[model samples]
Target chain A: MPVASLREVQKRFWDSLAGAAGIVAPELADAVVSGTTLGSRARLGIYADAYASRLIDVLREDFPRVAALLGDHRFEHLAREYLARHPSEHPSVRHLGHGMAPFLERRSDVPRFVAELASLEWARVEVFDAPDATPLAMDHLRAIDARDWPHLHFVPVSALRLVRASWPVHELWAGADPARLAPATTVIRVWRDASGAAYHAPLDARAAEVLRLLIAGAPFVIACEAFTDRTPLEAAQAITALLARWIEDGIIARIG
Target chain B: MSLLPHLGHGIGLRPPHYPRVADGTARVDWFEVIAENFMIPGGRPLRVLEQARTLAPVVLHGVSMNLGGSDPLNERHLGELERLIGRFEPAWVSEHLCWGAYGRYYAHDLLPLPYTDEALAHVADRIRHVQERLGRRILIENVSSYLTFTHSTMPEWTFLAGVAEAADCGILLDVNNVYVSAMNHGFSPHAYLAGLPPDRIGQIHLAGHSDAGTHLVDTHDHPVPSPVWDLYADAVRRFGPIATLVEWDDRIPAFEELVAEAERARAIEAEVLGARRQLA
Candidate 1:
């Protein structure tokens, strides 16, 4: 044998090495690979095992809460299923499980609870590495004139992510009983602390609606007007509570 | 093309040991970070990198450059690597000679490449593109493999030398990989080392491997075994105090234990180079 066709060889080798992909292109595996103490196919099996399991290990680390709820056998089943559906296209293994939320949702055996938990975990992962920025101090807000207050728009920190789930993902992630889960819709805010730790908390519906509008690049007046049916006092109290929590958690990047 | 200095014995900068290194409890001449690990936007890893940099130099060691792939160059990957280089200003950046990706899927394992001229040309072109985009010559390390291609026209060492020469890049001589591959594929480690050009060597890697009776896997989990340490001595005698790094990615030890492993390399370097001086 002289020179192997690089294109044909790689196509076949990868197709065969990827056992999860389920297609065995045999030309390269037939004649190109040399057998040793271990058979050629057995040798390739080592790499195939590593490729599938390495990414599974990455997912296990990323979604420990989901794994805990699903149990090791069930979680490994979903992970292998996820791997078969989504081959890692990213350079880093950190992003290998980017599609876990949607993947879980698409699975017939995976419960809606697991999908929501995976979403919440992925949000935490995104917030864990998002760029850091200085939060808005009270002076930055108080210095503004009363007239400009209504027009003020908040710049949420780069790490802020809103995960809306059909179940209480925060409690489930914090070790709640999955079997006792009630069907509920909740919007949770996940953010990185100033000290670089990640945390998530549930938000009230009215306040969460306001935050949703703000996250969509809405002005303070419009966001506040989202609570149109509420009384003036109730609206003012909700906005005050939201801003206090945002500021305390260091999620507000700027207000102008 | 080599413009970097010899950063003596070092350890792969791992997270478990970050707090100690940042707080000045651990000491090393330098640190080698997995480039992909720190390629993210910003986080504790970047902060720890900054803290570690203040103490000693850092080198970027990547596992996924995919130089020998048949697919088109991943411009996005290159751009992220360039961004990381601009921010960290690593003393040197190195990747493997094998390809980890092809088409859209990345294996994440350093897969083997056939040692043929076609492969040499293709990988050389990829390396040139990488060097041009990054504005710096990078080092390429030979990877350990379980099987070799039947159609390989040349030896792995010759192909490594050819790729480095053609691409005008430096060589990151991984002695542990050489020992592991030599043991696996029935090759002479001495011949492999002799095939490499002395001037092209920019760094050295010392690590542990797992023996499975028939073959050895380059698992950097345990301590450097006796055979690998002997290979390191042989390398020090030939390369004369190159930048050596201890890689224990799995089952990582305490900071002091890792430092002691690095210091072991320092002691071996002293013993090897001292004998060379006396013989001369």
Candidate 2:
């Protein structure tokens, strides 16, 4: 081949190698494996091994408690297999292997708790990078007549995240005492305050439904109806409760 | 007399240091920020940088300029970088003497360029073009490399000095990278320092490196080692109190610890400046 063509081929080969090891075209893997001077599949194994190892390292850094919960051997095995399937999508190492939790949840053999743990980690990252907005001030609420509370539309802070899981994701993320792990499920609301500290409020099913309704842009009056099944006319009381928590957390952006 | 007179020895700020900087404890005369980190839409990185900007003088050090590459410079990244520089109002903007992209593919690491007349004229022309585009002269820093090309007819130091002189740009002389590359390439760090024109040096860098027994990697994982500090002192003596920075990119310590490292550079600078003044 001409020098230019040869350089092009080399570039293509290396590009294929990078793509194969990332969350990209799998067809590139065969080319990467064959393009090298290894002469055997074992040499190409190094790429696969390094790819899986680097991603597993990223996962272990991002989700240390998840790895601890799954134990070393199981976490490494699962991470290796996960990278082989999903690869990485972003160029930044901060973004690599971020979807490991969802990938695990999709696997039939994986435990549901693993998915919950992943959601918890993802929520933490989301809260950290979420856009900044002005917190809803109590002065606005005081300005409104109490009669308008039912029709009020509450906008939560950018960092506010509502996560409902069959497993106790919050408990796992908090690294709570092992004895408390007996809980089968938990609904959690995670948010970062204006000061950039993260906190999670564990809620019951009724509160979770109310939060979901609110998250879906429902009016306070309509969201309160979901919780009315557990308590009578408690919509007013529940709205008051949630709004107070939101205010304390510096989470509410606006209410009108 | 300095373009960035308020800037002093400080680590290049990364994310792990965000909390410390946000808390307002990482003390130094200034902080160096990777230009790309703040290029994104509003997020914690920009938030922390904006907050830190209030606390200290910040200088923009970029990696993706690709000034020495065959490929055309990415004006999009430069435009975003310019927007960030405006927001932060950084004291100085600096990039590497090497390239990070080739033929449209961006390499995350700074790759060395062959030091020859052709490469020198190519890079110098690009530097002039870049200076014209940004409407300001940017500083160019020497890069750490693991390999050298046989096609090069001139030493990298001479090539770098040529580029600085030809393009009328300043030099952000990274002393630790010089030490690292000298040890790897079997050259004298002192010669590399001696090769540079003192007037062109606008800034200095002191950073830690990993000694892998065979080669010194610019890992920036620990305190500035004794030898690198000695080179930094030598650089200060030669360059005469340019903006000195301590860059720690990995295994970052507490805010106080990074400040302590910067303080070490301060003490060294004081000693070197004292010696230079006495000699004068």
Candidate 3:
């Protein structure tokens, strides 16, 4: 019998993992997959099962909250469908779920909050592994000359991320009961603490605006100017309190 | 000969066992980390690796090198591994003899390769490229195969020996994989062991597998069965004591349980080599 080329063999094996049973290469089935108690189809089934289960298990880890909200049966179903649509592109399993949230968004049974929850969950994984930075402390802020306060630009930590959602995704991430998944417009800050634990905080519109402007390299006074709906005194107070919280949370990498 | 040291006995450093291992009190000679896990931008995994490194040496074993694939090497993946090796300075790095991806599609499992001369050349060239990029030689392990290619003319061990010799790499020699593949494909495990080039054997791996009624899957979730313990004895007797590790990747038990398995490997190796010396 003629032997199949490596390329032909790989395409068949890869396609067979997602394909129906008995779809493996003809030579692999006839001459390669020698049988014992198990038939060749059953042997191939072991690998096929492992391929799906391993990738599905990875998705489950990355989107635990989303999986919890949807339940296991539905999540597994979604995982299988997602795998067919988005075969892993990278060598590492950690990257297999890069587009899971977007994939979840297109599902019919999925609520927007569930997809948003997936986004938050994915963000946490990212922040958990993101590069650490030396955060700016209250002492660092105090060290800054008051004369440069208006011109100061705060550098955010590498792990710091801001995500906007149509639902209160922070509640879901904090283990909110599925029955109470209220759809409220929310912006949340996600970052890793010094010991590498990930935490998320819900941000008010004013706080989100300040963080957005500051993250975009806006000067301190200009960042505070984003609170147009509030009084100047109120905006100043909110900015002061927000800066203190960020500093305490170690989200500010530097203030210049 | 291997520049890698005989690091006594060790277990795969799983995430669930991190708290105990990082507690700085867990007794272990070394920890085997999945190289891909630490090949990340940054986060708790690296932090945990730092903590584990303080306790014992770590070996970076990988599953996705795609050494037997037809496509060109993934430079980005190689670069990430190089950076990781620089950071961890592991005792050695190892990957399977099988491929994991083709083109942009990664199967994420150790897919079987035909042990034909053409494939031997293909994989050896890839291993050479990998060694050049890594700035150090690597060890390639035999994967527990669910299927074999009719095109594979030589036995798996002959292919492994050929690749190691042709590429100038070392053999990791996963013993349970030999047992599992032998059972699944009707090959003699003893022949598989004897066929290996002795000088190239750098490490040995012992892992648990599940019998799925029809066939056994290399699950690495349970205790090492008696047959594998018996096989490990043969391996130590034949290869004459190499660096061995217990791999428990799925449904990992407590750190104590994992450590106990590693200890079992230590005891078995001692018993076997001791008997060998008496016979000699």
Candidate 4:
């Protein structure tokens, strides 16, 4: 028999290890040298096991809340399913869970909140290592000229992310039981603080709308328009309060 | 005799030890960070890495280069790595000698390669490309494998040495991997070591492995076992005090315990080299 080319061997080896159940082809198995204790199949099985376990571990780390809710056995199952459909494309394992939340969203078998919870978890992961920026200080805001306040566009930090879910996923992330939860639209803002700690908070409908505007680089006046349902004084007060909170949370990066 | 500096003992800068590293408490001669882990834009990992570099020299150790793969090199991965090299100014950079990706898909695990002439030339060319792109020679570390290709025309060490010589790069001799692969494949660890040109050994890695009954797996969770320690002593005797690191990726202990592992490597290296000097 002719020796397999390097490409042929890699393809066969990868095919054998790619699936959840490693099915080593006859040609591939024939290529491997069987040891005294472990057979060719068993030897290939180690890579197969590692292929699943290592990726599953990465998913487990990225979505701890989802894992906690699913439990180890079910989480492993879900992770395997996720991996089969979406083998990693990026060189880094950090991006392995990029499709996980959406994958969960597409599955009808999983609880509705589970996908949202995963989205929240993945946002935290994204914000955890996002680009660093100097957050806008409250003193800086206070130092701004009153005339420039309306024209000022608040630049959100690079680490800030807004995850919207149909379910109150923040509660689920906070350890609320999934079974006891009710369907409610939730907007969670995830960001990294100055101390490099990742944190998330649920935003109210009005606040979420304004934050969305701010994140989109809208002028302060345009963002405050999100509170049009309230009186002008009330809207002004709310926008002031929100700005203070954002500045404190280190979500606002700069004033452009 | 090695081209790289003998930077004393070091440990992998894992997440669990970030606080200590950031607070300027975790002290070691050097740190070996997973290059992929720090390839991100910014966060605590990069911040802590900055702190780590301030405290000790750091080497960028990557797992995803896929130097032995058949696919075209991922330029984005290389660009990110080059960015990291420019920013952190690591003491040196290293990657595995195995392939991890095929085409668009990545295994994320260091998959073994067949030690044939074709593979040797292919990998050597890729390593040369990588070295030329990075503008610096890299240290390629051998991976622990559970199986070997029957079509392999040469021993693993020879293939490794051939790649190093052809690519004109250095070798990051992983002693634990040598032991694990030897146990799994039924080869002499000493012979594997002796096969390599000692001058090409730029660094050494010491880690723990788990016995899976059928074979030993390079788990890196447990403390460096006695046999691996013995192997480290042998490595010290051969390579003579190359920059060594203790790798504990999973089931990480406290920072102090991890430091203790590095300290142990220091002790073993001293013992082996001291005894060698006595013989002379």
Candidate 5:
């Protein structure tokens, strides 16, 4: 091979390596990095086997609670398949296996509970590494008066994420009875605070409405309008109560 | 380009221990930060990194240098890296001896490279180019590989030391990875340790490993195993107490737990320093 052609060969070698890692394909494994084992063909299987196992180990570590619920046998089955679909896009293992949820959702063999559980775990990771921000200080909100409230802008905390699912993922995530897993439409909020800690909160209808408005950049008065029939003060009190909780959790960044 | 004489042991300042490092509570001499985590467009990663920088001297360790790749180096990643160096002004920059992305496809894991003569010349030139681009020589650390290439001409340690010498860079000797690779490949761990050129070394990495039946895995999620710690002590004796660090990436206990790990490294460094003093 020409000296210049070596670079092309190197590139092809890496592509084959990634393909093998994703699918545990024997042919691809033979072309990339591998160790010799028992038989000529059997040797490449070592890389395939090792590749899947390493990724499975990473996924299990990242989603231990989910793994605990699914148990080893089922979790390994799902994790191996997930590894075949998502071969990692980011250099950090922190970003690996993020596509497990979509992969789980697409699989007919995956129980509905499994997909929801994976979604919740994946969301937890997303929220954990979400960027940090200067949360809305109490004084910053106080600066906005009722007159300018309609024009007020709001910023959601970097950690604040609203996830709605057909199943109670939060309940299932916390070691709840897997036997009791049932479809219950729900919305949950996950966020980290100024102090860099993560929290999960189940949203009631009223709070969820308020959160929607807040996320849409609505002001205190306009956002309260969606609550209906309540006086402005009532709405203010509800919004204040919710804001207090968010502020305490370090979720609210600033009133825009 | 190089660091001030390494102040002995340090810790991979992970998020779990961020608070302790940020508040000056962790009794660590120094900390190594992952360069990419802080390579965001803008936000808290930088803020926290700045806070950590204030606590102690920081070293920039990266996962995406793709040192062994055949493509032109990722100038975008290098630009981000340059900005981070400007902001944090890290003592030195370091990356693995393996490649990460090939073309646009990134494995995310440190993929092994063939240690043939062609690859050595190819990677050495790239390293020299990177050094010129960054305006400073950096350290290249060895990565643990599950498999070896059939085309490999030299042992991994020889290739690693050769890369450093050829590129005029330094070596971030990851002792745990050396031990892990030794176990996986059925090589002598002590021989691997003894073979490294101590003068070419800039830093030391001491991390935990998961014990598999046939081979040990470099998980960096658990506490340093006893045998690895023993090897680390031997490393300290050979390298003369370079800037050692404890890396606990997953199953991060508490801030105090990491400090306890750092404290363990401190004990080893002290022992090495004390023995040297006695000999002197």
Candidate 6:
């Protein structure tokens, strides 16, 4: 038999592992030396099994809420499908589930909230190691002149993320009974505290609108318009309360 | 014989012991971290790594260089590794001799290569390129394998030695992997050690393996097994007092327990070298 080139051998070996049943090509199988206890096919199967098991473990860690809701068997099945469709492109396994939420969104077999829940979980994973920044203190906000308050813009910390979903995913994420929940649009702010701990909280309608404006780089006066339902004096009070909360939460990185 | 420093025994820094590392209580000779894990922009892992470096000398051991793969080298991964080297200033950097990625897809496992002339030349060239990019020599560790290719022209040890010599790099001799692959491939572990150029051995890795009825799996979940320890004694006799690390990736135990394992390696090395001197 003619010797296969290095490239050809790699392609065949990869195909066998990536295939549905780990069926090694005859040429590739012939290339392998069968041991006394394990044949060439079985030896190759070890790699196949490890490839799936290792990746599934990574997915389980990244989306524990989704895995818990779906149960182990169903989660494993969905994860295998996800892997087949979208193999890891990143060198680090940390980025393995980058496409998972979108993939679940396209599927109808899972619950309606599963996709949103996945998005929320992935956001936490990203926020866990996104980047490090010195959070802007409340003193920075106080230093701004009253006349310039309307034009002041705030920059969010690098670890901050705002997730908007049609379903109340935060409730599910918090271990709320999925069966007792209804479809409700929610905006959740996820960020890492100064001590490197991750946290998330659902925003009320007014606070959500204001945070959205602030995250979009809107000036303080424009973002305060989210309180249009209140009087001018009341809106000023609401904006002050929200700014204090955001500063305490360590979500704002800079105010200028 | 190695140009690398003879740092004492150490353990791989894992997340379960991050608090100990942060609080300045975890004590060991050094720490070996996965390079890709710390290649990110920021977060707790990087912060922990910084703390670990301050506590003890840290070395960067990578798993995804894919030096033997058919695809083009990943420049972005190299760039990140280079930046990490600049920031952390690890004692030395190392990666596996096997490949893990192909054509943009990563298997995330140390996939073995056939020991043919073609593979030898390809991997040697890739290692040279990597050394040029990082501006330093790297130690390539041998991975455990379940099978071997019939079209190969050489043994695993010869291929490893050839690559290290041709690329002018060092070897991160993994004793447990040698035993595991030797058991799986029906080769003699002693011959595997004897074939290597001793001067090229810059460091050593000791880990546990699972006894699958047919073959052993390099799981690194258990304590360093008796046989692997025995092999480590032999490695000490051959390589002298080289830097060694205990690896426990899965089912990681408490920090003290891991450090105790490193201490055990220290004891064994002392025992072996002491006997050698007495004989002399």
DockQ (C-alpha based) per candidate is 0.66, 0.14, 0.75, 0.91, 0.24, 0.88
In order of the candidates, what TM-score does chain B achieve? 0.98, 0.96, 0.97, 0.99, 0.95, 0.99
Worst ten in a row by lDDT for model 1 chain B? B1-10
Off by over 4 Å in 6: none
Candidate 6 Cα lDDT to native: 0.92
Q: Between candidates 4 and 6, which one is better according to lDDT?
A: 6
Higher-ranked by lDDT: 4 or 5: 4
Between which residue pairs do clashes occur in model 3?
A32-B150, A129-B42
Q: Rank the candidates by lDDT, best first.
A: 6, 4, 1, 3, 5, 2
Candidate 1 docking class = medium
What is candidate 3's lDDT per residue for B1-280, written digit by digit as tens? Answer: 4337789899898888887766887679898898888887887788889888899999999888888888778889889999899988999999999988876789889988888999999999999999998999999999998777666789999999999999999999998999999888888899999999888999999999998777778999888888998999898888777888999888888888888988998998899878878988
lDDT score for residue A202 of model 3:
89
Candidate 5 residues A66-97, lDDT tens each? Answer: 78877899999878666656666554566776
**Interface alpha-carbon RMSD, every candidate:** 1.6, 7.8, 1.4, 0.7, 4.5, 0.8
Between candidates 4 and 5, the TM-score winner: 4
| lDDT-better candidate, 3 vs 5 | 3
Order of candidates by DockQ, top first?
A: 4, 6, 3, 1, 5, 2
Query: Over the stretch A1-256, how does candidate 3's per-residue lDDT look in tens digits?
Result: 5667888787777777866534776655664555657666666677788888888889998888888878899999889988888889988888888898898888777888888888888888888888878888898776777677778899888898888999888888778885777678899899999878999988988789899998899998898787767887777677878898899998998876
Give stretches of model 2 more than 4 Å off: A1-58, A71-93, A106-109, A176-186, A228-232, B1-6, B14-26, B39-48, B64-79, B99-108, B113-135, B150-154, B162-168, B254-257
Give the runs in model 4 whose Cα sits over 4 Å from its true position.
none
Which segments of candidate 3 are over 4 A away from where they belong? A19-28, A175-181, A229-234, B1-3
On the 0 to 100 scale, the lDDT of residue A102 in model 4 is: 92
Global local distance difference test of model 3: 0.85
Per-residue accuracy of model 2 over B1-280 as CA lDDT, tens digit each: 4544636677678777888788887666788988866665545687899888888888899877878767676777778777877788888899999865545554455666667687788789988988888888899999986555444678889999999999999998999999988887778999999999888888988888887665677888888899998898888777777878888877788777888888888888898888878988
Q: Model 6, range A49-141, lDDT digits (tens) per residue?
A: 999999999999999999999999999999999998888898999999999999999998877799999999999998989889888888987
Single out the weakest 10-residue window by summed lDDT for candidate 4 chain A.
A16-25
